[model samples]
Target chain A: MNVRKQFRAGSEFRIADHHPGDKPLSSGDKPADQLRVSGLAEQIAAFQDIFYAEHRRKLLVVLQGMDTSGKDGTVRGVFGRLDPLGVRSVAFKAPSTDEREHDFLWRVHEQVPAMGQLVIFNRSHYEDVLVPVVHGDINEPECERRYRHIREFERMLCETGTVLVKFFLHISRDEQKRRLEARLQEGDKHWKVDLNDLKERRYWDAYQERYERAIRETDTDPAPWYVIPADSKTHRNLAIASVMIDVLQDMKLSYPPPNPEYFKIKVE
Target chain B: MNVRKQFRAGSEFRIADHHPGDKPLSSGDKPADQLRVSGLAEQIAAFQDIFYAEHRRKLLVVLQGMDTSGKDGTVRGVFGRLDPLGVRSVAFKAPSTDEREHDFLWRVHEQVPAMGQLVIFNRSHYEDVLVPVVHGDINEPECERRYRHIREFERMLCETGTVLVKFFLHISRDEQKRRLEARLQEGDKHWKVDLNDLKERRYWDAYQERYERAIRETDTDPAPWYVIPADSKTHRNLAIASVMIDVLQDMKLSYPPPNPEYFKIKVE
Candidate 1:
């Protein structure tokens, strides 16, 4: 089956219908899956050069999920191999005083890719709707307005020279608990510890409900959102790399024709 | 009558229904009308100071019309007296080579007002839809797509803390002919004359049809389109300034509260 059709978060999607452990794209061999992901990452790097040289359209990859849902892992495993000059990674933390003074999207709009660039938002404007609504900082009507704003903003980006791919990294609650315990026990993982993440886990159900609503609201053509079963980190990377390969293949990216002017010039 | 209600080009609007020579905002005295326009300009200036000092929201004013429809004149007469720090006017004559390489809205998006500023587009992205459609450079489907892009783009801007007021300056063919003749016969007006504008007059009917369609498609609550009957330049100025006053007044512009901490500060 086409990976996009399999994982697409369409209007009819229900969050409960997807199982986190389902490895539709994986074979039984763990090393083979990782190897496949590496191969796909290389293909993406190859496409990025031509895409950058074409210099006509842009690409924006938005990764959104719970803290242990492997957003950072997917970035390193899938997009890390691309030419650094043409690719950018932005990890949105809490808004600064200056950013908070403006609308929520002011900082987001600043980081969207220009032509011929691929921008990965480790966490994006999606966090605005999710964290604020889940915490009750934004009420229902205001949340609805933000949803509308996001839909319109993304549609504009897609229409005006950008291809957008949004992923909802879906990991089960049990998997998150197991990962949290692993982090608690491992001394090396102390750097990744955040009391807020542990506190946020208390609102797991609320986050799930909000994430489902956000995905459904923004699951649109020209900018489709994919829900990836992300319990297994290797499979999560595999699934995302597959989606990127499919997206780049669909774009038909190619270098511009050899410049006619080049033939007329000679080295001094 | 409320200026917005009087001139708003909402659903069920027809260009033929609005007479170009109509002076709905006029007092039937030319010098008195001119004085009222000047008074309104001053009101705009006053409102602008508070609006700028409020330092929260942004404003975008779009003026679009046929050549010699008083677009430049309206900018000078209505917006000229405002604080230059907060007001920036952009005249988009033709897209440069770099601009053409990207989408139509790229240049326009870069010029959008940041927080607390008012930006005016003398001729905006609307021209992309208008000129291309009327000149047969764009077919129906492509024109429709451009309109959708524009609607989504403007809707996003409005939702992101920018107040949008779009005006289509309406002028009769006879008025255009008179203006063109004056530009031809007068020495001072020669600098403003463009032979392309004369050539474009041949497609006046096509242009009108496209304009009506564009207005109807984009007339929304957040970004309202006000049709200004621009036969009399002074009345045109009066109507636009009146609308701006209404919009700014609606926003309830005021400076931020005085900082209480100022009481403890002293200079050596």
Candidate 2:
């Protein structure tokens, strides 16, 4: 199956129905999958060079997932090969006091990709819906209103030449427990092991339900969502890389033609 | 001579006294210098990983130069290896109507690096000094006042844990003209060629004078300026990268110590 179509969320999609451990895009060999990921990274870099030089379109990749679902790993493994000049990765932590002074989307909007740039949102506006809905900060009607706002905003982005790719890194409860424990066991990884992650794990089922709702509400054809099985880190990277490369390829990106007049000019 | 000391602007520094085409950091071999640049890029990346993990310090790199002095190229070559998650490259263009309404530094203050992140300002608040002075929009008194404002603002940033590195990419007039002509001849590169760049080029001498004054007035120990000879693109990249690596090394960055208790935790 085409990776783009394989993992795309359908109208009736249920987060519970997808197996988080599945490796549909992998070659069934860990080393080979890792090698393939490296190849895809290089190809993505090449495409990014042209995309940047063309200097017309914008690309935004949003990663949303449960705690320990590998958002940071995906950034390093999948998008690490590209030059920093043309790519921006924004990790939205809790909003600052100043950011809270504005609307939820204000900070997100400020960081959107400009012409010929690609921006990856390590976490994104979807947090507005997910966190508020899960915590009962906003009721269903208000949640639905924000969904409409998001849809309108994304539609506007699309009309203005931004290409959107959203991903939900799906990891199972057991997998999360194992990952959390591993972080606890690895002394070197302690900095990343936030106590809040553990506190949030207690609300896992609520998060899952809210994530499903968020994905369903905002997953339009123009800004589709892909749910990647992220239990195995290698498979997670492979799937995201495959989906990203597919999206870039479908854009049919090409460099602008060289100028004939350029050939006549000589550096003095 | 150490690359850092070699390029650091002196109390008696005169921009005209520096040769824009000098390659003090290079091996006198183009390909060898290119390879060294790649090596420096990787080392910078490794240091950045630790810096990001340390999560306590802030880094701000400011690139200021004449038109076509390679601000964008410096970004790509020197900082390309960093994980996009931790680095932000902000290209400040002409102010929008809204930005112009606020104090000049208002927008700039909002974009400073938070703890454990690196931000590159392609052109920065220094523009506030250069453009107005060159165009006679501000009188000498106004320019001097703004310089004082900049110094106080920078001192505050340094005190608040931000380590600032400023680079003035020095390019000769003949080199600028050659670059402009090259851009004009290349149809593919036309998108990057702006009529305004040509117009700004007309203010070359004035801009140079203003730049010198800006650097002189603003160059303090905490936020010292390095005047890079930028005619040779390879040398420019090397010098910038060398100075940057030196700065990071001097920072003595190290990863947080491993947690002993983490090894005692077990997954459920």
Candidate 3:
């Protein structure tokens, strides 16, 4: 079952073509599917140990989504099983004043995976395309150029050894309303609710348009995007976990062969 | 039971006075003790949500030890439950050329936790006092100066609202020999067997002495040190998790009160 191929974003990808309510990956039994996700997480951990030992290949997982989408939840559920010492999950927020001085990629480039590392960008360089474009900060010409730069930058990363897995957690407008309203009503979750998220909701369709265009333009073979059906949190984790395991298994990860010299050495 | 105070390193502290094999924090049943660690890990996770919601306190956990003292395992065990988005565990390896150009603390200072974060230093600035000092890179007077700087730096961090929990994972020389022998013999573990770790083993006594002196010198109340007995891997995790929960509890963590204005806002 080529799970990644089924969901991979292509140049012709459209947000409307996908339904947030769909759960192609689910078994229809919610609890059972969640258990399967936990099982997949364990498999990922096993491979992660061997992957770290291989120490030659790099992996970068990019998660892009609208406000209230489960980007943070995906990281916590799937990648959380990997050794914290090895898996670095970086959540990119609004750029700091210092970061604003540099090109968008400058700060992002500083955080890419090195050899034997697995890095997760909670919200990534894709935000440059999503947020600014929705706000009309960049003209269409500039947006296209940024897309080209992204394509070239990602291509370079893939050519250099990074295996990129990008995801757009797709959720519907009504789901966002339910989530936002819940946050407003729930005190414990208020910290997570940036008031700006509600203000930004006014441009939901615009953001969706920008997201669809960005995904279409920058979608490449080496670094393709996966539009995950994220309306159901369990299904989202299940699908993303399935995709992650698929990618890692594709890498054919293994431990390095033992060295003869190491056996000859004595610890004393 | 003031677990931290019982294990705290003070000016009179000496590694010779402690036994790495001790399991004071354990239940004496390996399975039960391991289960307790898991339970404590869950508790830490629960507290973590409220702590993140509180969004005002910072936690910096520094883990330092000899090779195979279980710093990595402790991370995988205790801190693994933390949301990757909220917790960052930094494993400081040998400095790069660019890093060496700056002062020792430069790289470390840049990685400290911000409010609402928990940052773990797998190995940290203390390496400067341990490795370099063990190799005769600095004299006694210079070493004392570094200790003073460390104390002052930690004081400032605590004063600025960062709570520090530093651990010295104490493993016996014999245990390390056994672990190293196993690593050398196992094909799967070879990747983690850095030849430099073997070479440094020759300076075991010297490194221990420096660790003691450094811990004693800088073990101020603002940033006290807890000497964790790590020969028993389960006990090491159990103790660290216990201390972590203790510290987080002391903070009196709670979700911020519901904003009255938030109740009035309509998501649609």
Best by DockQ: 1
**Interface RMSD, Å, model 2:** 12.8
How would you class the docking of model 1?
acceptable
* Per-model RMSD to reference: 4.2, 18.7, 19.1
- TM-score against native, each model: 0.83, 0.52, 0.52
Cα lDDT tens digits for candidate 3, A203-235: 998999999999999899999999999999999
- The best candidate in terms of TM-score: 1
Error of 2 at A179 (Å): 0.6
Model 1 chain B poorest ten-residue lDDT run: B97-106
Clashing pairs in 1: none
What candidate 1 gets wrong by more than 4 Å, as runs, is A17-24, A49-58, A84-86, A96-117, A155-162, A172-202, A250-268, B53-57, B96-103, B152-161, B172-199, B250-268
lDDT of candidate 1 over A30-102, digit per residue (tens):
9999999999999999999999999989899999999889888888999889999999999999888767655
For residues B1-268, could you state the per-residue lDDT of candidate 2 as single tens digits? 6777889886567888899988887798999999999999999999999999998888999999999999999999999999999999999999986565334665787788877889999999999999988898888887887787677667757755789999999999999999999999999999999898998888888998888889989999999999999999999999999999999999999999999999999979
Taken over the whole model, the C-alpha lDDT of each candidate is 0.90, 0.89, 0.87
Select the stronger candidate by DockQ from 1 and 2. 1
DockQ (model 2, Cα): 0.01
Candidate 3 C-alpha lDDT tens digits along B1-268: 6998878888789889999999888777999999999999999989988877787878899999999999999999998988887789999999996455434665787787777888899999999888888888888887776776677567656755688999999999999999999999999999989998899999999989899999989888889899999999999999999999898888899999999999999998
Order the candidate numbers by DockQ, best to worst: 1, 2, 3
